[model samples]
Target: MEKGTFQDVNAQVVQRCREGDNRAQYELYKLYSKAMFNVSMRITNDYAESEDVLQEAFISAFKNLHSYKAEASFGSWLKRIVINASVNAVRKRRSELVPLEDRIAGDIPDEEYDDDTEWQVEQVRRAIQRLPDGYRVVLSLYLLEGFDHAEIGEVLGISESTSKSQYSRARKKLLEIMKDTHSMA
Candidate 1:
């Protein structure tokens, strides 16, 4: 397929599935299953639970296919479903607590943006994965996913200030991780 063609395929399949076509349902599952699994795994961090989340998310997505207006990309819509499923799985496991600190430390000012872009990308992703859940969620949503504090606050159900604080802490923690690795070398 050509670049960015999957969305077209999904749109067609979704249209068919909306009309109660079973083959379209199977095609949709085949198309999205692996990507959705990764989305669930990223948040849930458990193979079995991620699988369950994927299944549940697919079921939900299929049932709600009518609500998909194709205004947003199909992948984006499917991703939202997968993310919600993963988040629900996490909530089922345990409730997350946001820290009460009202004032977060300042963010690192743009310090001659790192020269080692490749090293930084890999190391930062690893470091982010190592952060506490709250920090990880805020960092992933804000930094990686390009969500503003307000959007993140709505998605994560925390105050915008809390999201900002968590992102600040996540950055600090990532820098610490990078520093430790450099020291080790």
Candidate 2:
């Protein structure tokens, strides 16, 4: 199906779901659950918590379906719900206190490095998982989820500069982890 046609069908399904059609609700979940689960997992960093967050997010989305305007695609709306739910779950698990002093790292100019090394996807994933929660969350939202620094700051309740700082630190840390892994291999 053409992209536009598929999106129209999804919008229709969302309308049906808003009207309390059980089948349409199921269809919507089937279409988005995997991607939502990935978003949840990336934020929560735990399989069980991700699953719980995904379920809660879907339930919340369905309950609030009446308020959903078709201004944005259903998937984007659902992703926002999933991200909010996952972040809430993580916050409930632990208090993320950002010391004011640490919020802004020194202005590090973006740097480029070239290396003749090929890294596996799993290696990169592992490196991401190893980052501290703040760095990982900012990095994932900015890089993997296509959120700009401003959007990430809004989502995470931090300043835009903080988001940029966290992303810079996360990138530097990720590279260090990858280099260590490569040397060991």
Candidate with top lDDT is 2
Q: Write the per-residue lDDT of candidate 1 for residues 1-185, one digit (tens) a residue.
A: 89868777777888999999999999988888998787666566556778999888889988898899899987788888887777776666655343312111232233444568866775565555566666766776676556799987887788999989888988899889778877875
Clashes of 2: 0
Structural RMSD, model 2:
8.0
Candidate 1 residues lying further than 4 Å off, grouped into runs, are 1-7, 96-122
Residue 183 accuracy (lDDT) in model 1: 88
Instruction: Name the 10 consecutive residues with the lowest summed lDDT in model 2.
Output: 100-109
* lDDT string, candidate 2, 1-185, tens digits: 77699888998998888788999999999999999999988887777889999999999999999888889988999999999998887677667564323422332233343543333665687678777778888999998899999999999899999999999999999999899988997
lDDT of 2: 0.85
TM-score of structure candidate 1: 0.74
